[model samples]
Target: MLFVNLPVSDLARSTAFYEALGLSKNPQFSDETASCMVLSDTIFVMLLTHAKWRTFTSRPIAPATTSEVMLALSCESRAAVDAMVDAAATFGGTADVNPAQDLGFMFNRHLADPDGHVWEAMWMDMSGGGASA
Candidate 1:
């Protein structure tokens, strides 16, 4: 299983933002200072409050304006990628942080959550020759 941990200034608001993007909170691993959001059977996102995050590391937290990483997720179809971007914008996220990419066999859109965590929703046609591109 893959777990992505992120620090947030507001736990409740961040939780809501991810939930809006189709992640369900797994209460079994959630608490007042943290929430485990399930994206799939093998993927989970751990949302941690600033205070809770400090327990794990003493490094200064990066402000929302800076980015540490950009995570990408595969979608079932090109339309799904578009839907994900639209949903992000409707729920406190910035859509199209980067220009949309379309290369015949692959399509992708970028979005940033309320805390400025970047994500790319992508669809690719692996069966086609474009997979090499």
Candidate 2:
């Protein structure tokens, strides 16, 4: 199972932002300080408040304005990638955080959530997956 944990300033706002991107909340693992967003059957994203996040990490949390990591998600089609970017903007996310790229076999865009966490929406032609990098 894959899990991505992010520190959020506001749990409610962050949860809503992810929901706008089509991930559902998993009530079984949600509470005041944290909420689990199911990305897939085996993938989950845990949004935790800074206070709660500290319990798991000794390092100071990175300010939202300064990105520490970029979360990338693959879409089934170019249109799906576009739609996710649009939804991110509509839900108070900052769009175009990174320049859009189209590589014939791949296309991608970046969106920043309310707390400034970067989420990348990408689409890659599977036929090229086996090609040498």
On TM-score, the candidate that comes out on top is 1
lDDT of each: 0.94, 0.92
- Report the lDDT tens digits of candidate 1 across residue range 2-109: 999999988999999999889999999999999999999999999999999999999988888887899999999999999999999999999999999998889999
Please provide TM-scores, in order, for all candidate models, with all chains considered together.
0.95, 0.93
Give the Cα RMSD of candidate 1.
1.4
Cα RMSD for candidate 2? 2.1
Candidates' RMSD to native: 1.4, 2.1
Candidate 2 CA-lDDT value: 0.92
Over the stretch 5-74, how does candidate 2's per-residue lDDT look in tens digits? 9999989999999999999999999999999999999999999999999999999988778989998999
Runs off by more than 4 Å, candidate 1: 131-133
Clash pairs (backbone) in predicted model 2 = none
